[model samples]
Target: MDLPRKLLAELLGTALLLAVVIGSGVMAERLSGGNMAVALLANTLATVGGLYVLIELFGPVSGAHFNPAVSAVMAWRGELPRTALPPYVVAQLTGAVLGAWLAHAMFDLPLLQVATRTRSGMGQWIAEGVATFGLLLVILRAPPARVAAMVAAYIGAAYWFTASTSFANPAAVVGRMVSDSFAGIAPASAPGFIVAELIGAAVALLVHPLLSPPRAAGREAASPPSSPARHV
Candidate 1:
């Protein structure tokens, strides 16, 4: 696909994703009556459904890579052109911030607020790493047809399992940093989460090769390997 079209897809897809995540979080918190569990559940469900649709919608055009970590991994693996990485990251980040603003507008909240929710600590960092690792692993290993569902399901589970609620995407960290809603992450804590997520993505890259059988030299030339169509 052309670079412009791919960038547009990434931008729009990431924006909508953040809107769903932050909007659902805000609505859930308002309606959960202080029950954090119930609020998170509502948020998780929205995110899962929204993510699945976005991936399916944008997969053909842009590979549905809404995360810089995922884009970087694809570039490293030669699936995406190395020259396109910077633009893809920029589009995703821009979309993320816009998505946050859109959510705030939809909820009639302040559009320029900052998140004060602290999400720092060793445990949280570790959780971010583990969450990202699992995400990339699933993307790398799952069948192309099942990628969207599996990714959505994994993220939903990660929201409950990870201490940081699985902010595995760097664009998501940036988006949430600008919002003060229930799904937001403080600007102070964004660095750690981003670093952990990148590390986790790297680990998944290394581990993925091990899971697949080594192809014989003659067979490798006969058939090229298939790659996943999308990632969150």
Candidate 2:
């Protein structure tokens, strides 16, 4: 409810998310024995399960917005306070980096390595945009009770459908940039992914209203409270 507690929720939720992503990728790659699809599937399954649990665990406290793009959209929509945006983003980013470190510690890898996996080019950027747009759209439209499950499912689907493996969150991009493992993206590729994600968020914001118009004033009281647009 309070700002400090909300920030803590965001921090913890995001940290756990990154740990799951990076940790699962590491494990998947090792066990998949050079089969990229198998590794990706394992990574997707872990991420989906982890994300669902994290959202349910932290949603009541901080809306469980582990993604900065999601937070920015919430702030713009007046769901999250504008003054709190910076702190929320900072917490998510800090948590992401810490999560990466935690994964490395667990796997006995170098803690300060940079990603050299080159993930760039027009197709990748476009895929990033499409991935983020779908993510935000789902967040904006899904019923509150189903948010966690729907978001996780959408991300899992996106992981296979999108060219970039759906790194839909900028904080994820940052976290993965520092890890040269299966889930990592090269530092040089981070900017394009981040930019595409932001643009996709903006596009989702614009497109959402067209799909789900505001309810009539008389129906406002009957509608559920839309205070926070929760997302992963």
Candidate 3:
């Protein structure tokens, strides 16, 4: 894929993902009368569904790494092109911030309010790692033929079960910090969340192979430049 073209696609995909998340969160709040469960279910479903489609739509070009952590993992796995990583990461974060800001504005919530919407604590932090690890593990493992489907399902379910609601993506966490709404992470707490995700991903990377297939033949040929198809 052409670097410029892929970069543009990645930017659009990230923006799209964040847009849906913010919109869904706002809608859930309005519809549920502040019911946390309702809001969370709505937000998670929309976010995961949007992500699933967005990634598929842009995967052929940009690898659909709407999250920086995913990009980092891709880099580690040799699936992403090394030189393009910096731009991809920059674009992803920028898109996330913009998306969150738009969500705040759309909901008539103050920018400052959006920036401080984080409720992170020790429990949430641990939840963050577990969710992110699961996400990365599925992306790394799988019966190559069904990787995307498996990833989307695993992510959606994890968001439902995990208390953190599975932020799962470091770039996404930072973007969330720009908003203090249902989607925001406290800027102060963002680093810890990011660190937790990295650690989780590392642990998953080490252990995932033991249970998955060793390789996927045709799958490897079409795999992203950075995501090596090492099942074993």
Candidate 4:
């Protein structure tokens, strides 16, 4: 995809994600009267569902990488072209900020707080890292080899299972921090979560070569010559 189109993909994808999570989250809160577990389940499901649909909708155009961290990893994988970085990152960040503001609008109660995600301590940090790492692994493996449905299913399942509750995307984390809702991260802790996620992403990069991509003179390059594995 061209730069402009890729940029647009990021913008639209993030907006869709935020709208789904924030909108569904508000609905859940209203329905459950702010039950934390219920609210989280609703929001996480929305996120995973939205990502699945968005990927299919925009897969051809811009690779549908709504998250900058995803874009970073895709670039590393040689999936994204070099020239696409600036526009892609800008688009993703801009969409994220807009998404947060939109979420604020939906859940703006009578001086009520936003429905933000506020996990901390060692458990929270570890969860975020594991979730982020697992998430990236899922992305790399699914499309090329596995079914797209599996891609979506794994994400939803992770939401239901993981302790960190899947703070898997740095872009999502930063954007979510902008609001004070069920899905928002405390701005103060945003940096740490992102750092942990980066570390996880780094680990994914280290093992990437062994999984797939290859060839020279009719010979396969990657050791396994297989696609990425899904860990979400």
Candidate 5:
């Protein structure tokens, strides 16, 4: 795909992803009547559904990589052109921030706000690492046709299973840090989450070859580089 179109797809996809995440969190919190569990359930369902749809929609254009970690890994793995990595990261980050702002606008909340929900500590950090590791594992291992469902399902489960609620994507961490709501993560906590997620991604990369060696025929059959074929 052309670079401009690819960048636009990444930007729009990431923005929509953030809107789904933050917007759902805000709605769930307001409608759940202070039932944290109920709110979380609602948030998880929305996120999973939105994530799956966005992946299907934009995967054909830019690999539907709304996460910096995913883009970074793909670049390193030779799935993505190294020259495109910087622009992809910039587009994802820009889209993430815009998605946060769009969520606020939709909810009639303040245009910009710093998250106050502090998520930190060793447990949270470890949870982030685990979450990201699993995410990368699924992306690298799943057959191209099944990647979207697997990724969405994994994130949904991670939402409930992980103590840190699986802010596994660095761009997502940045986006969440801007919204002070049920799904927000404090800016102070974002660095740790980012670091932990990167670590997890790195580990996944190292381990993937051992667990699921690439097939010579499969790469040829794989979806185009910009397709949501094997990426999330």
Candidate 6:
């Protein structure tokens, strides 16, 4: 696919993803009153559904990589052109911020508000690393036909299992930092999450090769590149 089209897909897909995440969080918080569990449950459901749809909608165009970590992994695997990584990351980040703004607008909240929700600490960082590692592992290992469902289901589960609610995507961290809603993470805390996620991605990359059997020589060249793991 052309670079422009691919970038556009990444941008649009990531934007819609953030909108679903932040918007659902806002709505869930409002309706759940003071019940944090209820609000989280609602947010998780919406994110799982929306994430599946976005990947299905944009997978053909850009492999629906709405996260910089995914794009980085793809490039390292030679599934994506190395030259394209910067642009893909840029698009995803831009889309994330825009998506947060869009969610605020729809809910009649102030635009560009900074998140004050602190999400820092050793346990939270560890949870983030685990969350990201599991996410990439699922993406790397799942069969193409089941990638979307597997990814969505894992994220839904991760939301409950991880202490930080699994903000596993670096682009997502940037996006959520722009909102002060229930789903948001403070900008001050974004760096730790980003670093942990990157470390998780690196660990996944190292372990991925061990999990898959090596392709026969020239076998890869003969076959078309497989579908990338859909990462929202």
For residue 125, what is the lDDT in candidate 5? Answer: 99
Instruction: Candidate 6: give the clashing pairs.
Output: none
TM values, all candidates? 0.96, 0.95, 0.85, 0.82, 0.93, 0.94
Off-target runs (Cα >4 Å) in candidate 1 are 216-232
lDDT of 3 by residue, 112-139 (tens): 4445665578888798889988888877
Q: Tell me the spans in candidate 2 whose CA falls farther than 4 Å from its real position.
A: 213-225, 229-232
The best candidate by TM-score is: 1
Which residue pairs does candidate 3 place in steric collision? Answer: 78-226, 79-225, 79-226, 79-227, 80-226, 114-179, 114-180, 115-180, 117-180, 214-232
Query: What does candidate 1's lDDT look like per residue over 1-232, in tens digits?
Result: 4999999999999999999999999999999999999999999999999999999999988999999999999888777888999999999999999999999999999999999999999999999999999999999888788999999999999999999999899999999999999999999999999999999999999998777767743463366544425454
Greater-lDDT candidate between 1 and 4 = 1
Weakest 10 consecutive residues of candidate 3 by summed lDDT:
223-232
Q: Which whole-number lDDT from 0 to 100 does residue 136 have in model 3?
A: 80
The Cα local distance difference test for each model comes to 0.93, 0.93, 0.74, 0.67, 0.91, 0.91
Residue 139, model 4, lDDT: 68
Task: Report the alpha-carbon TM-score of model 5 versus the true structure.
Answer: 0.93
In model 3, which runs have C-alpha deviations exceeding 4 angstroms? 108-114, 212-232
Question: Candidate 5 local accuracy as lDDT?
Answer: 0.91
Candidate 5: tens digits of C-alpha lDDT, residues 18-118: 99999999999999999999999999999999999999999888888899999999998778888999999999999999999999999999988999999
Looking at model 2, the pairs that clash are none
TM-score of 1: 0.96
Error of 3 at 177 (Å): 0.9
Cα lDDT tens digits for candidate 4, 1-232 = 4567667777987777766766776677778775778887777677667777777777666666776777777666556665676677888888877776776676664323443455677777777777766667766555553534665676677676766667677777767776666566777778788888888777776665567645531343333323212211
- Model 5 RMSD vs true structure: 2.6
